[model samples]
Target chain A: MGAEYDQHVAVTDLGNGGFAAELDEGWVVGGGVNGGYLLGVVGTALRAASPAKPDPLAVSAYYVSAAVPGPATVSTRVVREGRGSATLAAELRQGEQVRVTALATYGDLAGLPDDVRTTATRPPIPPLEECVPGSAAPEEVRKVARMMARFDMRFDPACVGWTVGAPSRRGELQAWFRLNDEREPDPVALLTVLDVLPPVTMDLGLMGWAPTLELTAHVRGAPAPGWLQVRHVTRNVAGGMFEEDCEVWDSAGRLVAQSRQLAMLPR
Target chain B: MGAEYDQHVAVTDLGNGGFAAELDEGWVVGGGVNGGYLLGVVGTALRAASPAKPDPLAVSAYYVSAAVPGPATVSTRVVREGRGSATLAAELRQGEQVRVTALATYGDLAGLPDDVRTTATRPPIPPLEECVPGSAAPEEVRKVARMMARFDMRFDPACVGWTVGAPSRRGELQAWFRLNDEREPDPVALLTVLDVLPPVTMDLGLMGWAPTLELTAHVRGAPAPGWLQVRHVTRNVAGGMFEEDCEVWDSAGRLVAQSRQLAMLPR
Candidate 1:
């Protein structure tokens, strides 16, 4: 098993509320580091700074500039501190340039009372065993797809044809996702894996890279052990921008994490 | 026309990256002030601070505590500033207690090239003229609904059956939205209006107030000056957690602003 996911996300003690993170070349997508991977590093730093609350309830990251693959430093400022929750401001800087800036809230997920219950439905899709493997990339976007190989993703049969030059009237992708590496799924790993999928535009016959402007992820509950299910879809593409809404469910069909991002449409 | 929207969102000049804001009692959603209304005031501060870039691209607001209706002061720290964009961190304090914290990015919307052509579709629903208005609250929730009366919302006929005790198999709400108080639509108004719709859980027969834990909004482009349509839906409501995905379209049928929030279900 590869150590890329764990090594790339692990942060070192720089002391004084500051830490250093490395942007592995393997995680690069289209010349820049993956936005989710960047946040995973920052979230790791935030978690280390405050051991009291380990789970990141929410992380809102804005990409300021391209983070070239290499060493990056992250520093955090505590906005507010309470009994079981803390709001923090963090930035990952490559030397003098701030590559990514994020505002995050961390809380005790284990202690959160999830008492209210209702029949939550997953979107209509086939069973995991019946879906097709989906790591193949288009000839032009193989550079991105290769980096995405770090995550083991198998797509629903109906959604996998878009990569083979089949045109779709809608923007949708459903898959069972887990890291190719042996590391188990956690909140930080979930953060990195959430954005590793191909752009939904590919299904609708659009090309080129779509960089994220702002991404916000909310950890609903601690992910259960096993392959997590993810559904990524976009309903609107307007004014040179499109939204990616991701719903991640645990192995038991419980929703554990959800994210939404605004990304620039490929030019 | 009532000046409540403008007066409530207007920030007084305090200089030195600081501003004074007050929450009018009429904007209270329950026992606490509305989270979106608080951010709108903070958005006003950010816009005033950077007149060159008047459009708000993103805002991630975290509710630290219950903000009482009255005077509040806001202080901002500049995270990063560039030629065309700026990301700032701001916090709201009622007195000695910090009530709200947000990280916002503002930019010039006019100069951004919207050359990417896309065919984005809104959810299946009736047109604005065919839907009925939706301000009716359960007898016990009138106190909260009174605060929501500031917005003129017409719900999709299919989703409104929940209010009358009809069971809905899924959670969805599509409505034509605009400020009932007659304030023209802008970025801040768009932010406030995006979250003003009734929670989708109501359609699932869930009761009580669903308070937002965190909200992130992305303004696509400056909205055309007219009624902005919105679609609010939740794909899952598990373990007392749910996500509200909102897409706001302008009068010209262009997607303008989008938002996602994680809220706690009332016990």
Candidate 2:
């Protein structure tokens, strides 16, 4: 199941609960490394120390500052270890700067009992044929065009408005998503995909890179194995900050992951 | 602004980077202290040391173990302090057990630059007169009924089903919320409000107390005075766990806060 994404987030154990990761340059958006990519790096480090099968059910990270693309060190601590679940904490630092502080809860997802199963409604995802690329960014707005090239995002046709400045009235976008590298979605991959969606504030015609201040991802299950149905929504944009809520329903239409991030609103 | 809620979360600064808070027994749910209550206590401790106004814009906490209501100690560290934003990390420990680990982002909402604004639709909350008390608890489910008594929650009339074993067809709920004590809603109060709603999974016919494993809240703006329009949705319930997505829309119909929590489903 290891794909190119594994190489990008791979870390080397340095013993004494420490691991070092070489930040992938391709994952950098703007001057800062991508928040989701960093999350994977941190998750990978914590997974190495997880007592259970490293299925990260919930991971929350606070970005202390931007980490330039290079080598970063992750220091992990097992906060509480249980038979089926464990809580691990880690600090990702480059040089003397702590770039991210993260807390993750890992457990054996498949091994846990799924007795009382019930289904919920999923966002309507457009067919791949009717869908287009993620964004309609023109030359002026395509700052992360390079970053977008790395994901095979088949977006809803309705997402075209923000590009030419005829944006939607509400801040919501639906899309079909999968990694460009063709990696099978895992808990770590799902964490990254949850953050890869374009900020929903774009529909309000806001412009600028929305750097995530804090992000939390909860993986509900191992994805049913295929393209993910994604929905990103923003209900408010005020005081130079906003929250983006993203949900990923697996290929079989089973809900797999949900995330919320507090990010700086576009300037 | 001091109310009974404040007294419950009040802490004494240890002069060093530490604070001591006497656990308020009334806030305990089940055998464990409420996650949001501990969040408010951590937020309060972090606010005292924030270089900014200490308005917590985002906070995420991971429960290491259940913290029984009693005297607990909170040790805080100012991770990064900026002109308008700050990041703080803290751990809540009872005796030798570390119960909760949290990271918080503090910002000055009124002080931050708010040049542009956009609005999104809010969930339609039924009139308080049309609504009813929160839940139809049986004698067995009445354990948390005393805690529920503290909040003036005008629940959606539709929530009456689960009690009679006739739950809603979907994993969604709508309610109007405000402090039962009629205290003005502030950042800390918002944190507690985000966690008070009955677990949406109950609508799927799941029973028992759902202890939160991790919870994250993002504050968008201070609420205008009055009852808040709130909605809770659960998309996935798997592996003995589930995630609840909650949104808080102010009386003015402004999106004031949003939160997501991962919790153990009722056994």
Candidate 3:
């Protein structure tokens, strides 16, 4: 870990019905804090605003710029508040330049008939000990991993032994992750974990240098308590961009979220 | 504008690397029927065969599904011919199931400073007409105008109309479209249009639905040009389970796609 990490929430006077928080980073690398960490921060902030609520259903952040280590601030503003849902806009800033901007939606629990169907399929989850752990990731990745210990990840050997000349598309990996400190399962927390795993796995599978340019995830059902299984598959690598699609499943083998990401491979 | 929209190509597969083609559906929705189109179709299919591609530079498809009023087939495959600078995939499909897939990469297009840095910022091109046009649209959309002609679209005014309602944290809409018959720009052509217009614009600058979701775009730049721009946006209604996001845009201002879906909106 890069020293101790700290975060602080700050409210702004924008008065648009949103709240903003400032995060103090001890040693966050420029490109280290991927989408997962940002989601965690945003989720924590939103949870704080709604003391009586559990957490957000889904929150999305746009990576406008890389989050560097040191003190940074986050601001959120409410856009609409209805009986069932609420929307908030959050921004993270270092100095004059804005680092990240996000939109989060919150709502109450409404039981639904189990009739609705979903097409998401989860990969078989092997025991964490049986799987292989990923090799040392990029320096930046390690920095963020230390800050968030929620995920228990393992890599397949195929990923670590990849070579440029011997490019193969068969490399795959699986991660068994859940909330740190074992908090009751919540949708927002589940999504946060889903967003983080794809990039790491993709990087390993391709044995090619790549970073996510954008990520979008759709939730199919409510999350249940248990270890979430993420099976990441890399389908294409061309030009300088790669794509990864992930299927997230709850412990009961229930599919929760289906995610896709577009990333730029290092040249 | 041709007599009895002709059948261009046929989609023969639906695996990872799939295909979609333009049938007798008047005019193809997006890409043209030629080598460029084949390149993209094959790319997507190839990526699907082995490892999935990361960043899809652009995607153009032939209106293959019942979604469009036509009969066609699609065939797709991978063409891994380039080294590091570029990666390409292709797709070709038609008829029901609208089989079409593409996975491509432009690798890293950034490098040594060539004294020329072209960051041309164009003023927002005014909509074809001063006011939204009058055209026929699907029932889901409350009003239909030439704005529909300018692009392919399906929209609901209640969800994204000028009217106001309960406050929600997020909102959304979806649309399918492409540019009017004129020129065929490369992958950058479609992205150029998308990158400029913020998804938040679907709100019509409404204050209540101000929260913006992270925009995620998947592109399979193909030959069939002309019509391209299908989009949607959703807003979080309440309880964090109901969120809405809108998609609105067009190829050269011709609206092509539109949609509205519900999501878990948390409070």
Q: All models: lDDT?
A: 0.79, 0.81, 0.42
Interface RMSD of each: 2.8, 2.3, 14.9
lDDT of 1 by residue, B95-194 (tens): 8888878888888888787753545665666877788776555655657656666777787788888777894747777888777566778887888877
lDDT of 2 at A47: 84
TM-score for each model:
0.89, 0.92, 0.51
User: Every model's Cα RMSD, please?
Assistant: 3.2, 2.8, 17.1
| Model 1 residue B251 lDDT score | 86
Docking class of 2: medium
The TM-score leader among the candidates is: 2
Give the per-residue lDDT digits (tens) of candidate 3, residues A44-153.
Answer: 66655554443464454444456655555566555444444455555666676555555555544334335333323455555767665533456555654554343445
* Prediction 1 global C-alpha lDDT: 0.79
Which one is best on lDDT?
2
Q: Taking the candidates in order, what DockQ does each have?
A: 0.49, 0.60, 0.05
> Which of the CAPRI classes, incorrect, acceptable, medium or high, describes model 1?
acceptable
